[model samples]
Target chain A: MDTLTTPQVINSEYLLKHWQGHRNLTRKVIDAFPENHFFEFTIGGMRTAAQLTAEILAMGAPALKSIVDRSEEPFSENRFNLETKAEYLTKWDESTAAINANWEELSAQDFHETFNLFGLYNFPVIQNIQYFIDNEIHHRGQMFVYLRALGITPPFFWER
Target chain B: MDTLTTPQVINSEYLLKHWQGHRNLTRKVIDAFPENHFFEFTIGGMRTAAQLTAEILAMGAPALKSIVDRSEEPFSENRFNLETKAEYLTKWDESTAAINANWEELSAQDFHETFNLFGLYNFPVIQNIQYFIDNEIHHRGQMFVYLRALGITPPFFWER
Candidate 1:
C-alpha cells in the first residue's frame, strides 16, 4: 500500500454526506418511537432511547466545535435540557446545522492532526469524526430493537 | 466541495483498519456473552444474540468474496451451522481472515465500482462494504443491551 500511488477512497465532503445519511435514518428512528416510549422504554435495564439520544446529541456538533476551537471541554450529556420528543428533534436539527458549520472551518490537514475529543479520547481528527457516526449508528441500532420490541419496524438500515 | 482539490481522507488500508477495529470490539462483545444467553436470551421478542451474530457472520466475508468474484449470490445467514459460542468464535476468526484475503484482491478503483450486494443492495462497492461495518455495530448495540440486561458490562465502545 504505497501512500503516494494509492488513490484516495473518500474526501471530507463525502465523509460528511455519509454521516448525514446515517443521521437522516436516525431521525426517522426517533420519529418512529411512540412519544411515551421515547423517554420511558427500556430493555434489560438499558437507558431509554431519550437518554441514548442525549449522549449522541452531546457529541456531534460539540465535538466538532471543540476541534475547530481547539477547546478541551469535558464531555457531558446533561447539556441539553428537554422534556419532550419535540425538543429532542429540535436539538437534533440544531446539532446538524452546527456540524455542517463547524465542518467548513476545518482544513484537510486538520483531519490528520490529533484532537482530544471531549477532553478525552486522544486520536486523529478523522477518527474522532468517524466515531461520531459510529456512535450514532450504535445507538440507533438499540433504538431499532426498541422499535421492534414495541411492535414497530425501523426504517430499513440499508436505505441510508 | 471541489472534488479535484479536496484531499482524500482515507485509503483502502485505513478503511480496513477502521473496520477491523469495530470487528475486534464486536468480537469482544461476543466473548462477554454468557453461553446460554448467547443462544437463547431475548428482550422484547428480539432475536437472540446468536441469531444476530449469525446475520453478521453471513455478511462480511461473503460480501467481500462476492465483490472479488463478481458473483451476486443471494444473501443468506444460514450458511454457517455453528451451534455454540465457541463455534461462533472459530467461525468469526475464519471470516476475519477471509475478509483480509478478499480485501487484498480489491483495488483502489474497486471502491468506486458499483456491485449489487447480496443481489439486493445496488450501490457503490464502498457503500456496501460500509454497510457490513454499520450492520455489525448495529447488532453489537443490541447485544450491549442484552449484556446489560444480563448484569454484564460490555467492552467500551471507544476501545475499538
Candidate 2:
C-alpha cells in the first residue's frame, strides 16, 4: 500500500481566481480613501497609500515577466515609482488582466520548475504565484492600518 | 563597497515585520470569525477556515522541528487533525509566541543559513519569514472570499 499522500497541487485557474479576489478586495479598500487621501496617508512611517498602490501595480507585470523569463534581478521598486493614483490603478487593472490572460499558459509541470525572481534563486511557479498574492495582501494589511488610523472604515473583508 | 541601499535592507526588515505583523493579524481575524463558520464556508473548494487555521498553525513548530532535526517528513497534516478550534488556536498562539522568541535567538549570522521546512529544503531565515507570512495570507485570502460568499464581513484588514 502506497501510504504516501500526494502533495496538494494548485492550478493556474486557482491562482488566477485568487489573484482576482485580491484585486477586488483591494479595489474596495482603495475606494474607502478620499480622493486626496489616496495619495497620502501613512502609519508607522511606512509607505504612503499611493506608494503602496504603486507597489501593488508593480507586482503583476514584473512578476509575470520574471517568472516567464526566469530572471532573478530582485524586481525593481524604482520601476514602480508612479506619479498618480489613477496611473497606479490603471496599471493594477492591466496587470490583473494580464495575469488572468497568461495564467493558463502556466503548465502543471511548470509548477515544480525553479525560476529566479529578483535574484532569488530556484523558486517554483507555485511559489511565484504565492509570492505575488502574498505581496499584495502584505501591503493591503498596511493599508488597513492606514485606513483605520485615518478614521476610515474599509469595506468589510467579505464585502468584495 | 557596501553598495546595498538602506531601503533594500529595510525591505528585508519590512518583510520580517510583515511576517510577525500578519501573525498578529491572524489573531484578530480569528476573533471575528464566528465559531460555526470555522469549519464551513470555503470558496471554490479552497481550504476551510478551520483547515486554513490548521495550516497556519502548522508553519512554525513542525517546520522548525524539521529544520532542527533535518528531517524530511514535512510535518504530517494528520498530526493537526484534532478535536476543536480552541485546541488549534491554543496551539496557534503557542506557535506564534515560539516564533517571536526564536526570532530573537537568531543573530545576523543565522538568517542566511538554510533550515528545513516541510521536508523540501531549508531556506534562509529571511526567506523563511517571507514564506511564513505569505502562506498565512494565502489562506487568509481564501477566508476573505469565504466570508464574502457566506455574507459575513471579515474584520477590516487592520484592526490590529
Candidate 3:
C-alpha cells in the first residue's frame, strides 16, 4: 500500500546552505570588531573575541578535515599566526573555503555515521556537524556583546 | 545488496537529552548574574539575557505545539509574566515540559518534514530543531560576555 509517509527533515543540500548562511553572518561579525579591540579587550574574564574566533576556527577547520580524513584529535584553542585582525580574517576566509570543500566530501549517509569527535562524545555525524554550527553561533553571540559594548552595532541574529 | 547506509543521528530520545544538557548550562548562566543585573544588563546593543531567553521560549513552546498540530506561526520575543528572573526560569521550565510532551506527538518522519518556521524561514523540521538549539547557544554566548563584563563567572561551555 506504500502507506509509510516520507521522511521530512531538510535534505543534505539544505543543511549545507543553512550552515553556510550562518558562516556568512559570522564573517560579518568578525568584520564588525575594531582592530585593537578584537585582540585586547576582555570582559568578565572571557577570552578576547579574537581568541574565541580562533578557538572556533581551530575546531571548525580541523573537525571537518577529521570527518573526511577519518581521523580524530583534541581541539586546539588557537591555530597559526592570527596576530593581526587582518590575519584573523585571512584565516577565517581560508577556513571558510576549506569548510565548503571538505563539506562536499561528505555523503548523505556519511552524516549518519558515527565519528568520535575529539576522541570523546561519540555521536552521529549530524550531531557532530551541529556541534560545529552550535559552537560558531555561541562564539558569535559573545562577539555580538563585544561589539555592543564597544558602542558598535553588531549585526542582527536574523541576518543569519 | 543493501547499499543504503543507515542514518546515524541520535534519535528523538538523545535529541531531547542533548537539548536539556544545553538548557541546564543556560540555566546556570542565568543564575550567575546578580538580581538586578539579570534584567538590566546589555552588551553591544543585543537583547539582555533575559530578553534572549524570552525569545527562545517564545519560539520553543509554541513551535513544538504547532508541529504537533501541523500549524506554523510567526515567532515572538517574549511570553507570559516573565517580569522577574524567577518568573523567567519558571517559564523556561514550563516550556521544557511542553517541549517534551509535544515532541512525543511527532513521528520520526516529522523531523524531515518542512514547516514554514515563523512564517519566515521554510526549512525542514530538523533545521528548525537545530535552530532552537543554536539560538540557545548563541544567546548564552552573549550572556557569557555579559557575565564577564559584570565581573561574574560564567559556566564552562563544555559542561553542555
Cα RMSD (angstroms) for every candidate in the order listed = 1.9, 14.9, 4.2
lDDT (tens digit, per residue) of candidate 1 on A14-67: 888899889989989998999999999998788899999999999898889999
Which candidate, 1 or 3, would have the higher DockQ against the true structure? 1
TM-score of each: 0.94, 0.51, 0.84
Better of 2 and 3 by lDDT: 3
What tens digits encode model 2's per-residue C-alpha lDDT throughout B83-145? 576776787777767765555555444444676666564665445554556567756755654
Rank ordering of all candidates by DockQ, starting from the highest: 1, 3, 2
lDDT of 1 at B25: 94
- The segments of candidate 2 whose C-alpha lies over 4 angstroms from its true place after superposition are A1-9, B1-160
lDDT tens digits by residue: candidate 2, A1-160: 1111122222245346656876888877877777777886654344677777776766676777667666675856658566666666676777767777666566556665777667764655655665567768766755665566567766665344
Better of 1 and 2 by DockQ: 1
- The weakest ten consecutive residues by lDDT in model 2 chain B span B1-10
lDDT (Cα, tens digit) per residue for candidate 1, span B1-160: 5443346677789999999999999999999998998999987788899999999999998889999999999988889899999999999999999999999999877887888887888888888888889989999998998898789999998887
User: Which whole-number lDDT from 0 to 100 does residue B12 have in model 2?
Assistant: 29
Q: Global CA lDDT of candidate 2, please? A: 0.61
lDDT of 2 at B26: 76
